[model samples]
Every structure is written in structure tokens, then in C-alpha cells.
Target: MYLHSVAAYLPAAIIDNAHFTRLNGLADEWIIERTGIRERRKAAPGENSNTMAIAATDAVLAQAPAFAADSIDLIVVGTYTPHDTIFTAAHAVQRHLGINEIPTVSISSACSSLLNAVEIVEGYFAMNKARRALVVVSEHNTAYNNEEDTIAGHLWGDGAAALLISKDRMSPADLLIREVVTGGAAPVSKADEAVTLKPVERGIVMPFGRDVFQQACTYMARVTQTLLDKHHIPNQELTYLIPHQANLRISLNVAKQLGLAPERAVSNIERLGNTGCAGAAIALAEVWDTIKAGNKVIVTVFGGGYSYGAMLLERN
Candidate 1:
């Protein structure tokens, strides 16, 4: 599969650290030192996951003027936070785009949902089931998080990203999807309860922060290394490392474990906080234009479900 174009949508409402300080009594320095997030975007009154996904998709389509919307045969949305569970963000996006008679699916694997969506596209391409696919990852984290909660509320943010992918390269600047690997770590101790969101009950909460952090640092780096080793690519050869925007510490730890410079890792958490599954895709969209031909990039993620994955891409 080849990545044709990508774009991201961040809500205009900015929630600074001071808001958390006033709500949860968490100081700005304390939040920054732990999560590296000074501010994050929150969806406005009318905005939701589907709307954000549509915005991102519109931006991506606008970027690729040559690519017709009618050519898209698959639409996949990755999101854990949905405005309407029954209607689903995927169907909403498909309806908004006016693309008909195609397979539309929604997937949720916590924050790792983005890569899982990409893997689904890979499967469709391999089976000759689809050619051009539109994958959108949108997260309305603030919709299901309590700002008053001191545990993990301050980390929540709202954002969305869209990627236009094709079974074959559509342009000279297209990025080839070299490999994608994803798996779950539910068998690990405390994996299932480390983080959770029960919209009907308590919203999003992190009961076992230390366990989540330890597993995220371990699995994210391990998965990235797995991909690199499989392709016989050295760590120094990697042009950029785009890890899930969960925390700055986790990203830096993963980069260090891989023997890569911290600067090599692309991060947006400092400004965007954690946008759930949309984090990696947003980072990819942010850095897409600057990536040169022959550059090797890795997008790795570890989510609350104890799911972990990595995708290797090369600009060609």
C-alpha cells in the first residue's frame, strides 16, 4: 500500500494547563514534567468525532486535487470515543463524503487503533478487495473525560487525522508502506485495568499509571525494533520516529531504548496532549511535507487496551 496524502484537524478550543490546575489542582509544572503537555485542543459545542473526521478528510482530499473522491472504495475510521455509538464515525464520514456502495468500518483498539486501521487497508489491498482506501482516525477524548478527575483527565485532547492510501503508488512523492505489525498484551498482569473509559459510569480513568507507563515504554520500543530487525534496517538509518502521543517520557524512553537520538522522535504531545488514536496520524500529517525521498519513517503506538503496533514507511 502507498500513502497518497494525509491531513489533520485540531479543535480550536485551547485548554491550557491552568484549566487543569483550576479544575484538578494539578500545577502546570507538574503536568509538564509528567506528560509534557502544556495545552490541548477541546472540541467545541457542536464538534464531535465524526465532524472532526470529516474535517480531516476534507483537508486530505483538498491536498490531493488529482485524486477523485468517487475512487475511494474503502472507508475505515479508528476511534474509541464516538459521538453516536450506533451510527458510528465511519458511517458518518462515508455519508458526509457522499461516497456510496463501499465497505465502511469502524475499529477501536484504544490508541493503537490507527495502525490497526492501516493493517485493515493492507488486508483489503492484499486480497484485491479494494484499491484506494480512506482511513480516518478521530478522537473526542474530552467528550468522555472528566476535567475534574485528577488521575488522567488533564491528558485528554480532541483531534482527528485522515490518510488517503492506494494499493499502488499514485505519485512520485508517495510513501510506500513497507510493513505493519500489531498485537495485544492483554495477557500481561494489570494490562486490562491500567486504563479505561466507561462513558456510562466514570468516564476515562487511569488506575494503574505506573503499569501503563512501564508497558507502554517496553512494548512500543520492542515493536519498533521488531519491524527494524525484520527489514534488516539499522536504528541510525531511520529518518524519523513517530510514536503515539501519549506522553513525552514514553516517546523519549522508546527512542533511547532503540539507541536513536531523542530529536529523531517526532512528538506533538507537548502542544496537543494525547489525542487517543489520532495522535500518530496527526504527527505523520504534520511531518509529511518535510519527509524527503528515501527517508525511512516508523509510526509506533501502544494503547490502553495493551495493544501495540508499528508501521514502517519509506518515501519514494
Candidate 2:
């Protein structure tokens, strides 16, 4: 699969560290030192995951005006925080785009949802089941998170991203999807209980921050290096690293493990907080235009469910 276009949507409402100070009594410096998140975006009144997904899709369409909505044969949305449980965000996006008779699906693997969605599109392309695909990742974390929770509540944010992918390269500037690999570590000790979000009970909670940090730091680097080794690409040859926007410390740790410079690792968590699965995609959209031809980029992700994945892309 080739990426033809990409776009992201961040809500206008900005939730700064001071808001958490007032709500949870956590100081600004404390939050920043621990999570590197000074501020985050929150969906405004009446804005939800579906609406944000549509906004991102519209942005993608706007970026690639030649890519018609009717050409999209597959629509996949990766979101854990959906507005409605029955009516998914994928269908909502398909409806908003006015494209019908296409296969639309939604899947969630916590923060790793974006890469999983891309892998799904890869499968369709491999089987010749789809020609053009639309992948949207949206998160409405604040809707299900408890602002009062002092543990992980402050880390939640709302955002969305859309990617226009084709079975073959559409243009000279299209990003070639070299490979995508995903795996689960739920079998690891205490993996299932490390982080959780229960809508009826409590919101997003991280009972074992140390465990999550250790596993995230380990697996993100492992999966990234796996892809590099598989392609026989050396660590120094990597042009950029886009890690999951869960924590700045985790991203730095992964970069160090891979012997890559910290500056080469793209990060938006400092300003956007952890926008769930949309974080990496949002970062990709922000830096898409600056990437040069022959550049090799890797996007590695580790999510709360202990799911991990990575994707290798090259500009050709």
C-alpha cells in the first residue's frame, strides 16, 4: 500500500496543565516533568470521534483533490473511544463522505490502533480485494476519562487523522509502504491489568505505570529494530522515527536503544498529550511535506492493551 495523502484534526479547546492543577491539584511542573505534556486538545461541545474523523477525512480530501470519494473502496477507522458503541465511526465517516456500497470497518487495539488499521488495508491490497482505501484514526479520550483521576487522566487528549492509501503508487511523491508488523503482549505478566478504560466504572487508569513504561520502552524499540534488520537497513540510515505519543521518556528511550539521535525521533506529546491512537498519525501529517525523496521513516507504536506494532515507509 502507498500513502497518497495524510491529514489530521485537533480540537480547538486547549486543556493546559493549569486546568489539571485546578482539577486534580497536580502542579504544572510535575505534569511536564513526568509526561512532557504542557497542554492537550479537547473536543468541544457537540464534537465527538465521528465528527473529528469526518473532519480529518475532509482534510485529506482537500489535500488530494484529485482523489475522488467514489474511488475509495475500503474505509477503516481505528478508535477505542467511539461516540456510540453500535454505530461505529467508520460508517459515520463513510456516510459523511457520501460514499456507499463500500466495506467499512472499525477496530481498536488501544493506542496501537492506527498501525493495526494500516495492516488491515495491507491485507486487502495483498488479496486484491481493494484498490483505494481510507484509514481514519480518531480518539475522544476526554469523553471517557475522568478529569478527577490523578493517575493518568491528565494525559488524555482528543484528535483524529486520515490517510489516503492506494494498492499501487499513485504519483512520484507517494510514500511507499515497505512493511508493517504487529504483535500483542497481553500474555506478559500483568499486561492485561497495566492500563485500562472502563466506561461504566472508571475512566482511563494506569495502575502500573512502571510496568507500562518498561514494556513500552522495550517493545517499541524491538519492533522498530526488527523492521530495520528485516530490510537490511542500518540504524544510522533511518531518516526519521515516529514513535507513539504516549510519553516523551519512552520515545527517547527507544531512540537511544536503537542508537538513533533523539532529534530524529518525531514527537508531539509535549503539546498534544497522548491522543490515543491518533498521536503517531497526527505527527506524520504534521511532518509529511518536509520529508524528502529517498527518506526512510519508521513509525513504531505501543498501546495500553500491550499491543505493539511498527511500519516502515520510504519516499520514492
How many collisions per candidate? Answer: 0, 0
> lDDT per residue, candidate 1, 1-316, as tens digits?
8999999999999999999888778999999999999999999999999999999999999999867898999999999999988899999999998988899999999999999999999999899999999999999999898888887889999999999999988899999999999999999979778999887787889989889889999999999999999999999999999999999999999999999999999999989999999999999999999999889999999998799999999997
Residue 113, model 2: Cα distance from true site in angstroms: 0.8
Model 1: residues with Cα > 4 Å off, grouped in runs: none
How far does residue 287 in candidate 1 sit from its true spot (Å)? 0.7
lDDT of each: 0.94, 0.94
How high is the lDDT of residue 262 in model 1? Answer: 98
